[model samples]
Target: MNKEARLSRLTRMALGRESSDYLSRDVDELTMVEELKNKYGLENVYRFDVGKNIDGFSPLIQDVLETPELLGLITGSLTEYPENSYQRLRRQLSLHHDIPPEWFVFGAGLESVIDHIARAVLDPGDHVLIPVPNFDVFQSVSFRMGASLTFMEMPGLCWDGNILESLCRKMKEKTYRLVWLSNPVNPTGQFIPQDDIHRLLSHASETRTLVVVDEAYGEYTDRPHAVRSASSLLKSYPNLMVLRTFSKVHCLPSARVGYMAASSERLRQATNTYRPMFPFSWFSLYMAQLAVLDGDYVNEIRRRNQERKKCFFNRIRQQDSGLETFMFLESDTNTLMFRHRDLGADALHGLLAERGFLTANLNRLTGIQNQGFLRMTLHGDAVNEKFLDACRWCGRHLFR
Candidate 1:
């Protein structure tokens, strides 16, 4: 009478492979936070765990959603049942990125895209090279697919010449079917430079390794100076695949839309081998299309995000609170990871949670070891001020 016992042996093994430390505390604590907020009617609870583009739907998106005609489309007969709305989306995205339409493939989200790619390419014992302290999905999916994984520890939370040399040396020494790199890495918020990526891709091309560059936070690096996307290198390096999501800068995570870019040949191989039928709903497709066309809105969001991040960083640097903090430099993403001098990440997380603030505790994430860092997303000025005040209160009253 055990439901879990009925699972296929493969499924059981996959479940067993799940990391006890990766995404365990933060995800579970987030669920608990939501329940308490709803049950106790707590309006002031702040969640810095999830990296949503903004607090809620953007003004333009909300306006589009409220349109009666637009809402009616949700109930109308399906226009493209077999192919769904992917044709339209592919065109828009292609025009946006200046790539051929055949170069794009859609998924419910980046996580879904990652799963699809893993399922298509990974075979039992296939090697996958991933840097440590990354988004846990990379590790989880590759492992579940029964792929051999090699984790390269990124020293100081970012890659340098030594790390790059070591990574390339490993690539030359081993045949990796896939290499997963998260630009502006999750949990760390450090942006790997374009030159370093080029160096890796150059080696990957010779080794015939598929380099999947996850640009989930790549849009955030556009302002002040543009960070050229690895997608631009797709024409030159056919071994490269770039993944992007509308969840972050586009403010449409609820729509569950994400896509991958590669050479048309690579797309054709993946499509011919394994393709998800109608991966996006009509409502999701419609909103995602609108979000994509609203280029001005996206640009404004990026501008404001950069300014707000700068202000937040400077304020943290200048704060006279008893709590001392440390942060990584050159982070161009929505999230920031830092540590309290005197408290472990779990202890600080507990203090903040009690004060109605939820943060991602990095005490046990791979590559972080016992560093005691916690990751929090950048919010608006007012909300960030409240968080800073909470930290000061923890420092002055609790620690002192």
Candidate 2:
């Protein structure tokens, strides 16, 4: 096929995959919607999207909305809307990172920011380096921008020095424009060490390539502020940008607020070229400000996430030896990636979904040929127990 024809085909596949919400099966679990309607004689099923609340936002959100001052700030800010609230949010985020306010652009979300970055920086046929087993949005962005994505596997189990050497080698062969990576990787939940991050930044500077570090899950880590220190690397390495969001940690996925930090000049160019509007609602901004500023809420969520992770992993280890379970490289985060001996991930996922449990099928995520590997997110004691019970049931019935 001609290059154009091939590109068109790839775009079609990417668009189809991106258009569908991958976690719909999980939504089917909220039996209370219809059950409550039938029991209470309500007119319609008042469905609560349970899957959306990975980070519980009940009493805290309610309290934030009740504050008149907070609401006033949101309304006042909206009156003379700055070029973009995204930019203002980016400035607030940079303050946390100790990065200058001028060093970033605000986008509706990390996905949009990445898409804009790809379009702004890469020409058709340009090569972009990315680590595999990443969020699927990276593939969509790369394909949409007409850039050829070059995949590099992360060092297994941990960050390896050789990965940097390999990246340096690739840089020498071609003048690649961008290198995109997640700090604490999605699905795997592994955090690359500070040394490795520095090495990657150095390599990027040497190659004159931009290194985009996606730190979406940074706040969920034990060191909720480690990513703040990461911004310091940009001082010496102009070719570095850090991406952060309120989605994962703040549990504000519906807010759609994410931003990037780079040199002030880069930020200016990005804002001028692709100015992101207030895609997020006023209520979202109010809630996000409340969430971010409340240190207690952030720390409590992190602590709970850590506790849940430990409980889940401990239970997994105690499972019968007949089930082949492989733990993720990084165990600190709330997500666990594992592989079993017999059951295929798809079948296992379906079985779990039927029982009101939802997990990420790694087989589909990494495109790795693993029959039994799946990723589960840890919520709390009650939720963790429910998940473990589901797994145990699956082990006895499916594996047997």
TM-score for each of the candidates: 0.90, 0.81
Deviation of model 2 at 93, angstroms: 2.5
Please list the Cα RMSD from the true structure of every candidate, rounded to 1 decimal place.
3.0, 5.3
Candidate 1 has which clashing residue pairs, if any? none
Give the per-residue lDDT of model 2 (tens digit) for 160-259.
Answer: 6787678878887888888888877765677778778898787777888888888887776535554334677878777787788777767787777777
Could you tell me the lDDT of residue 217 within candidate 1? 89
Stretches > 4 Å off in candidate 1: 1-9, 20-31, 34-42, 77-85, 223-227, 264-268, 271-275, 325-330, 397-400
When summed lDDT is taken over every stretch of 10 residues in candidate 2, the lowest stretch is 44-53
Q: Evaluate all candidate structures by whole-model CA lDDT and list the values in order.
A: 0.78, 0.66
Question: How accurate locally is residue 256 in candidate 1, as Cα lDDT from 0 to 100?
Answer: 86
RMSD to native, candidate 2: 5.3
